[model samples]
Target: MKTYQEKRHFDKTPEPPWRDDQDKGQHRFVVQKHQAAHLHYDFRLEIGGVLQSWAVPKGPPLKPGVRRLAIKVEDHPVDYIDFAGEIPQGEYGAGSVEIWDKGEFDLKRESTDIVEFSLRGKKLSGSYALIHTADKNWLFIRRKEV
Candidate 1:
């Protein structure tokens, strides 16, 4: 979380501070609506030990066969899964944050680039794939039911 910590100052912001002893998450995921410089959805998955993050500019798709642009962001702490509040002014992501949808998900496959998963969330409940399109950019696609 070096990149995560470098962008934040724990003393001035309300964002979750990093504690190196955190648990490897239980396949949990979260989508946060962030009203920062722009309105975007922060999609995160608990992978490995940290929360791998992406900033979806147009939000995620609820309908199958739809694609949304997702830009890969820095890793967040495990505790950030439940984080929802305002980041103080001058902070890295200084804006109002709210949980859009959250629930457990099942990973079908993953690699350094692509990740295929099945989400069991309030607004999203089906198979989804995040395919790497290019540097720091990916396609968040809702897979059609078979």
Candidate 2:
């Protein structure tokens, strides 16, 4: 939480401020197309009280057998799930951001090596897997539809 707050000035950006909304029942998810220093997809899942985030450098793969690099990032406030705007040029992650997909998901499985989930989003609706590749690194892959 400290790292996320330290990286941005809420007053300078349209990003949401940290709030303690402890809604554990909300199993929501969001994918934001972020045009920062590089184009990437910000994948977030509402868990605990924050949004666990990952930055997929090549964006999320839409089909099975394709993989995209996902880098773990700081957890964001739950309110940030709906944020879509441009961050100031000097601020961290400064650039345009838009919601690519927003919906609910079910955590199917979680283990040391892999996480399996099913996302029911506007643009993405299917099972997906995140395989831990290395420290803070993972591979986001779409699973074949059942």
Candidate 3:
């Protein structure tokens, strides 16, 4: 979370608490509707004790075979999975954030260029894949099946 820490003043923002002792056995995920400078969805999944994050401009696609651009972002603390509040003005993510979806996910396959998973959230429950396209750019696609 080096980049995540360096970008914000935790003292000023209501971001989730940073804990190096976060559990590693949990499989969690969250989609936050962030009304930041630009409206976008922050997609996060718990992996290796941290939240591997992405900024999906239009949110994740729910229909199979559909894709959305997911820009890779800094890894956040796993505690961020439940964070839903306003980030103070002048803060790194100065805006209101609300949990759009929250639930556990099953990671099926993973590699440097692709990650296949299945989400079991209130609003998102299906097989999906995040294909790394280029630097910091990935394609989040809703797969037809596992």
Candidate 4:
């Protein structure tokens, strides 16, 4: 996997996150200010040849039984980790960008094809899991003790 610093050149273009072929194994966590209540932070991971994304409304709750909505977004390139600046006016996600948290992860378990891993993030702190629902779809949930 390419380190976040190695993908700097791909950031020069404004194309979709998956535009260039150099985006393989890329992941990004984005904190956006929507036109609604509360700020949202997006957690995305590169897996199965696509960018698996989730929108945590409360920035990934820290307790059990607290489920945050993980809305999937367009597949973004792995280089997005280094993206921190204004997204320009009138754009779809027009807001300031910041690299909140990032690092490599390891899959701890998987049964019935569902894979789980320990997550390390800037705003989100805890162990998380990713379950593959379909060929191109997946669900991200944090691990909570019962």
Question: Per-candidate TM vs. native?
Answer: 0.98, 0.93, 0.97, 0.62
Q: Single out the weakest 10-residue window by summed lDDT for candidate 4.
A: 1-10
**Model 1 lDDT per residue over 1-146, tens place:** 88999999999988987888988859999999999999999999999889999999999989999999999999999999999999998999899999999999999999988999999999989999999999999999999999
Q: Summing lDDT over every window of 10 consecutive residues in candidate 1, give the lowest-scoring window.
A: 16-25
Model 1 segments beyond 4 Å from truth? none
Give the number of the best model, judged by lDDT. 1
Clashing pairs in 1: none
User: After superposing candidate 3, which stretches have Cα over 4 Å from the reference?
Assistant: none
Better of 3 and 4 by lDDT: 3
Rank ordering of all candidates by lDDT, starting from the highest: 1, 3, 2, 4
- The sequence of per-residue lDDT tens digits that candidate 2 reaches over residues 1-146 is 88899999988999988876656658899999999999999999887788989999888888777889999999998989999999999999999999999999999987878888999997888899889999999999998875
- Candidate 3 lands at a TM-score of 0.97
Q: Which residues of candidate 4, in runs, are more than 4 Å off? A: 1-19, 23-38, 108-115, 122-125, 130-140
Steric collisions counted per model: 0, 0, 0, 2
Better of 3 and 4 by TM-score: 3
